[model samples]
Target: LEVRQCLNHMTDIFDLIDAGVSPGRFDLAREKLKKKFGEDAAILRMLEGDARWIELWIAVANTVKHPKKTERIVVNDLRLLPDRRIQLPTWQLFHSTRCLDAPQALLESADIVIQNLLGLFENLFVVVIDQVLPALPSGLQWVLDDIPEAERDPKCPQRYLLSIGMRNARHA
Candidate 1:
């Protein structure tokens, strides 16, 4: 598709998502989108690549796992969409995970966290679908599903970002 068409398509999808549609329905819509725009991951990674969703995912996960260490890690500095400082959590997470100073490495670690979270999300949905969906009031599912996190898809957009652009760009 042309750039304009791509933009238009993305615009429409965001519009639906902003309308608070169910994730199942949104996931279905994305499938339909992929049929035309190639695989979902390609487009998803493009939109998601380098987005603030990474830091947010890291923030939420770190917060939940280590609430007592909240003061040590603050996610307030990353107003940028594609936050490069994903390693902030490792330092603040209260775990002995090796420091990830390289921004690209930090981004990849963030993706790992996101992938783990997605597993949690799918499992949570499976359990909730039968028990809660039937019992909850109308329109509650879509509004509560939380797509703010959906912006991150278990993979970094720029996992191989040239954090240290080479002195030997092409020495071979």
Candidate 2:
């Protein structure tokens, strides 16, 4: 459920960026983006590249909706530790395991999935911003100028901050 919610949140961000191109529903907006930007568009490419992550997210979401389907999905992606904690393939959630006990592993797994999805969203936002910024009105060009030199890169944390700020400003 939380994983699905996170994906929805990221989609909302994409919908916002796509509003100028297609003002209606998010599905239509995404289609418009694909039509306008072509198959090689950064957003489309990023999403296509994250197929495995999306599959896992969907499987988990389905399991949440239908508990009986849980067995079909690999809910044990993380290994439980002897200390009543859980560890991902690469990292261990020491504090979370200690605090939440048995459920902490599942929570941490959801978090990892959410973070991966957010990373894709961040990359897509950078691409969309790069494509849109230059076409903005001269007065609005100040927005990009206001971004710090370090945050200029799309992958930088500051870039995501700037993107969200711009998104909020547009909505307001």
- Candidate with maximal lDDT: 2
CA-lDDT, candidates in order: 0.37, 0.54
Model 2 regions more than 4 Å off: 17-32, 69-111, 131-172
Q: What is the Cα-based TM-score of model 1?
A: 0.23
Each model's Cα RMSD: 20.1, 10.0
| lDDT accuracy of residue 74 in candidate 1 | 32
| TM-scores of the candidates in the order shown | 0.23, 0.51
Off by over 4 Å in 1: 1-104, 133-172
Clashes of 1: 4
Per-residue lDDT over 1-172 for candidate 2, one digit per residue giving the tens place of the 0 to 100 score:
6666666556665544554432213345456668877877777767667765665555555554665521333334667889988666432221211221243345666577757866776676676777655454433432432455565765654533442234325522
Per-residue lDDT of model 1, residues 1-172, tens digit only: 1222222233343332232223223344445445544564444444344234333444444555565542233333333346653333222233233223323334555566556444433433333333333333432332223334545455632211112223435321
TM-score of 2: 0.51
lDDT of 2 at 82: 98
